[model samples]
Target: MTLTLAIVGRPNVGKSTLFNRLVGKRLALVDDQPGVTRDLREGEARLGDLRFTVIDTAGLEEATDESLEGRMRKLTERAVDMADVCLFIVDARTGLAPADRVFAEILRRRASHVILAANKAEGAAADAGVIEAWELGLGEPLRISAEHGEGMTDLYAALMPFADAAEAKTAETAPVTDVAVDEDGEAPALPGNDKPLQVAVVGRPNAGKSTLINKILGEDRLLTGPEAGITRDAISLQIDWAGTPMRIFDTAGMRKKAKVQEKLEKMSVSDGLRAVKFAEVVVVLLDAAIPFEQQDLRIADLAEREGRAVVVAINKWDLEDEKSVKLKALREAFEHLLPQLRGAPLVTVSAKTGRGLDRLQAAILKAHDVWNRRVSTARLNRWLTGMVEAHPPPAPQGKRIKLRYMTQAKTRPPGFVVMCSHPEKMPESYNRYLVNGLREAFDMPGTPIRLTLRSQSDKNPYKGRKKPGPSKLRKHLK
Candidate 1:
């Protein structure tokens, strides 16, 4: 088992910078703004020869109630309890505050192993604050600059004993690998091939994306309040749901581009877009009372354009007065307004009560399976023959347009290419016909499909013969 380390501190103490440095990548968002990270993010950290799982938690606040800040503090405390070693960081520029001391007391009682570090200890200006950090009664404070990469050797020395202990315990408890005396030698123990699927949940502000994830986790794993835009960073978590392993990303609420004026919020929106590109299935959560807003349609359309399988989820279903009537209306609006996603699954779920989650899971699995569905070349050609025979291509300017053959070039939002004559003259209406026919005949619904038309004359016909020099050209001309 790998050792786990948690970085805890008050707001704006460079905890995330240190996490990015240790992990050698900026996986967690870092900003001059305080309380930017509201969730616990875990990454594999490497310091010298030591390897461990490091968690970057939210800035520790004094509130312990149901407010947003209070919920953030509770989530940080949960990280402190789960980590094997707690690295308590303090700002060296601005001496120890009262909140830092309070957090020190909390970590002292909760965490098994604690290492005190004074960040921003690069110049003489931070000397006094480094000295003040020792007054918290957590032993000597290692003066280090997480931004400048100073004093890492001392931090490594402080954590070596814990790493050693964890390795020793793991050796004693871990099962030995089976060995074969034959030539194969049991093939050793390779890594497991069952990696988790990637999924992203996105929607407008206050759409209850975080609440839905918390319900799935069976705990308050994400920070959620009655405020709009509570989540900022795209936080990903690995979990096993209904016997399938998946890595689900809970993205920040995306409002209109006009409303996104702040630089921080712009960065947050960009991060959410990146998550959508990397995800296999994107769930567009919409409030039941205000379903099919303009921004909601835009978000879902963006997913389809990116060639990702989409699942439209209507949240806050428990607040509805007439369930059947509202559901019928929603289906009608979905089909009429967003014809591009005609067959996408529209599921109603109550994040507050966890109702209809099983249906949501089923929809997700079905969408993913369809997204990866493949069609054989022979079958695709047969379907193409029937489609072309049913509705023949148009004759533009007395020129016949014949589609010769069709074959699927790829899966995962299946892409197909067709060999056809007079490809440029093929109208968009005819292309749509073939695309819709493919979706119906191949049983692939809602997932984006790419259709390409190519003519045999489309290829370049360049000659490799060299050009004659000036004298030879003159003789040939004469």
Candidate 2:
């Protein structure tokens, strides 16, 4: 019963900017160019006391019925229809235009409730557009500077009605608790038995990774003395933060090969890589002073390739000023910096002060849930059928590669095994397409998605009409 809000507008109307603002993270990609955001991105949003789900949709444009732009528009409209409320954003600096009016008409005809926002309204230059928004006839415009986070309180006030209703519905329908309880209601909590979210804190040397772990644990459990490479062992500790159980792994720091002269440092580096493989969710800790080093992207790519849920935590945020400035910049950098893991979770936290520890843990849990998610056979086939219609698989070597069926093989990393006519002959790019579709359909981003092609055959070796072996014939001849 999560409340859903859809942000819709033409391109460069600050939809992503407002999306990032509401979600309190740089989760969506933001740029000055139009159409930078292609998909409908959803995240948990918080505004003042209101918390709900928000979907940032692609810019709407009129195009040919079956063109890509039209498809993108259809996706946005679909989101609008599904949402409890819609936030129609218009650039306050530019005032209303024909394109904005067209989008308004579309939403007016379909969307149930629309909240208008005049974004980028920081100074006098935006005053006129704020007044102009009244013409849209949705309601009084809430002048907001999404980049600077202005007028969010007023926005929150407007959202409380929807949020409260959604929350009430959730409370009424949610199942009774007591995951550990039985019929008798007498159950002892076992030692280290709580469902703790498994998180691996990893990064390069002196990225303040160990220090972050120490702060989260609220003690020197990791033996942090400021000297690099002090923590060689990948120690796992169970702790509770805000009533949430977490299994935290503090690994040895990694360093570049050119600088590693000590034999012990080399082992520590190898140990860190091994720890990454072992984690259910990996938090790639980065130093705020120097963000996204080449090795950092490599490690993140490795985790993604290995099919692990990834959350990038930019540590040392307490030292930065105009924090939003840096957060916005870092996110823009990450889009191009780690395109392989595009849409991966990126969080800025002062692990030193535990500023964003709760959100970080929540993001980790979400990524893990997505990683372990499995779609039912009926729903999967339905989705697959639609996908094949949208984009049919190509013919390889004069034969159409028939993907007969698909089923989730296992969970940990959420692997899918597809039974097909010729798995070996399936193109690698086609495999990637299936993987990407699985990720988008399941809403799993920042986690490695595994799609394995498999051929179905009889289990028995002599299932068909096989007769006696050559050995039996030779025995008769002897």
Candidate 3:
């Protein structure tokens, strides 16, 4: 157990900038806009020789009700309570405001260890603001610039005492028992399987991605409400999801490109896309009322294009009035709208009531398995032989495109390469036939399959050479 530092302050006070400085990565999205960060995102931070866990919290607002701002404030307070130390930041450029004092008072009462810091105090213009931060009554403000990496040594000096105490406490505590355990609760993970699977939940705004994850966690680990796009960061949480060790990333609601005009929203969407690229499996949560909207279709296609295993989950199923008709309609729409994910699992779940989660979990596991499914070359060639015999490749200009051989090149969204004559001339329809046939024959439905065509003549020794002149051939023989 290491020390935890929570960075808290009002909106646009550079808390996220300081967090990125400490973590040495742009894990948290930062922008000029206020309240860009809405969730408590944690990262492993390193400053000087010290290493600790750092949490970047939402901007504190003067609200305690169930509104978005109020919920954000509560979430920040939770971070302050759990953290070993709280670093309260104030905007030096703007000077101290009433909200700063208000939050400072809350920190003084709640946080056992609080470090007062005035961020963006880099220039002479901020000197007055730095002096003003002392009026918050926490202590003398440490002047630091999170963006330019100024005054980090002072911040490090202030945190050393708490780090020492946390180290002593960790040495006395019992060891953690969060190891991998099967249903029997004794088996260990296989070699090369130490890390949990990476899964990302993504969809349109207000699709209940955060709610669905909270239901899966059985806790309010993520902030959720009636507001759309409440989540702004792609927050990753590790959990033993139904005996499967997995790291689930809850991404910000992604809107269509034209409507995503704000710079902050663009960064948030980019962060979500990066999560999709890193994930092994993606769960596209859809609203039951509008299961396959155009944006939803695009998101699903994006996941497929990234070669990630996808499971379509229709959230809020409890509100639906016609289950049978709706399910049938959804299934039909799913197939018709997204032909690439034709056989992918479409499970209905109510994130509000935690219904159909068991089925969702089963679907996720099944999709992951299919994504990693591999077929032996012998079996694949055998299947290819039959596929070709049934419907031979088209001959354009009397040139029969013979698929001479086929082999599985990789798994985890299966990829294959076919050695054939006139591979470039191979029509898209024939490639689709092979891809579909491989999916059905190898039980790899719904997962993206990569099929590459290459002419076998490229491997021939004489293929690329001009017909050697007779004299050149004689010289070579000599």
Candidate 4:
């Protein structure tokens, strides 16, 4: 098991900055605003030779139980419980505030191991605040600057012992390769470990993307409000639902290209696009009141073009009055507008009321399975023969076009290669026909299918020519 460290602090103490530095990526959003991080985000961290799992948590705050800040504090406390070590951070430039002391006491009581870090200690001006951190009574304060990358060597030393012990323990109990044989004198296949399924939720502004995620987690782990564009960064969280581990990404809502004029919005959109590319399954959430708009269609088309498993989710369904009529209309619009994602799962969900979430989860898993589906070469060729017999290829320029063989080249958006006599002469309509046939025959829906055409005549034309002519001429000259 890897060592887990949690960075806990009050609002805007550069906890996220430190996390981004350790993870070697700008995964967590950084701004001048406080409380930007509202959930616990985990990443693989490396500092010199130390490797561990680092968590960036929401700032601890004092508030009533029903308020948003209170909810955020609860989430942060959960992170503390899950961590093997807690790095309690304080702003060295501003000294220790009351909230910092309160959180420090909380960590001292709850966590078994704690490291005191006085951040923003890059300048001489922060010397007094660093000294003040000593008053917390948790050992020596490691004076460091997360943003400037200072004093990391000392931090590495503090964490190295724990990492080494964890590694040694893992080595001692490692699984053995030797196994018992069965009655037939054959070894049984070892059980495979399943990785967490990666899913990204994306949609237009104010489409309840964040709300849906919070509902799934059964907590207000993500910040939500009535205003548009409240989520400026793509935040990922790991959750286990019905015994399956899932890493879900909550992304900023994307607007039309023409409407996105601000620089910040552009960056947010780009971040969301990156999340989509990294995700194995993408749920395109739509507003129930105005579902399948032009922008919605464009977003779904983008997922298809990226060759990702797609699931269309209609959110805020609790607000819709005409359920039957609206569902009928949405289904029709889905087929008409996004024909490329034909037969994909369309699920209705209410993020606020937590309705129909089970169906949505099922659809997402089903889509992922379809995305990773593979067809054997023998079955693929047999299917291809049937397809060609059903509808012959169109021969351009009066030349006969023959599709010689077909085989699946890869899975995960299921790619295939078709060898033919005149590949260049194959029309786009025929390609679509074959792709559609593959989807239907293989029970693959809403997952991208790739079909590549290769010409058999691409081989060398003059392979058997003898080299005797040049030798005969040389001999005559001699």
- lDDT (tens digit, per residue) of candidate 3 on 1-478: 8999999999999999999989999899888878888989999999999999999999999999988888888889999989999999999989989988888889989998999999989889999999998898888899999999999999999999999999999888958776777889886757424688889999999999999999999988899999898888999988887788888999999998999998888888999999999999999999998778889999999999999999999999999998999999999998899999989999999999999999999999999999998888999889989999999999999989878888888988899999988988888988898889988888888999999998787466877777889999999999
lDDT of 4 by residue, 1-478 (tens): 9999999999999999999999999988887778777767889999997889999988899874856677678878888998888999999999999988888888989997999999999989999999999999999999999999998998999998888888888899999887799999998764322468889999999999999999999987787877788787788888887767898998999999999997767878988999999999999999998888889998999999999999999998999899999999999988888889999999999999999999999999899999999889899889999999999999788987899899988888999999998888899999999999998999997789999999788566777777568879899889
The sequence of per-residue lDDT tens digits that candidate 2 reaches over residues 75-149 is: 788889999999999999999989888888889999989999999999999999999989988889999999999
TM-score of 4: 0.81
**lDDT string, candidate 1, 1-478, tens digits:** 9899999999999999999999998778888988888889899899999999999999999998888888898899899988899999999999999999898999889999899999999999999999999899999999999999999999999999999999999999999975545476555443222567789999998999999999998988888889999988899988888788888999999999999998889988998999999999999999999999999999999999999999999999999999999999999999998888888899999999999999999999999999999999999999889888989999999988988898889988999999998999999999989888888988887889899999866455776667799999999999
Q: Which residue pairs collide, candidate 1?
A: none
RMSD of each: 4.7, 25.9, 4.3, 4.8
Runs of candidate 4 with Cα error greater than 4 angstroms are 1-4, 32-35, 46-53, 59-74, 77-85, 93-114, 123-125, 132-139, 156-194, 261-264, 458-464, 467-478
Q: State residue 429's C-alpha deviation in candidate 4, in Å.
A: 1.8
Candidate numbers sorted by TM-score from highest down: 1, 3, 4, 2
Alpha-carbon shift of residue 3 in model 3 (angstroms): 0.8
After superposition of all CA atoms, the RMSD between model 4 and the true structure is 4.8
Candidate 1, residue 435: Cα displacement in angstroms equals 0.9
Candidate 4 clashing pairs? none
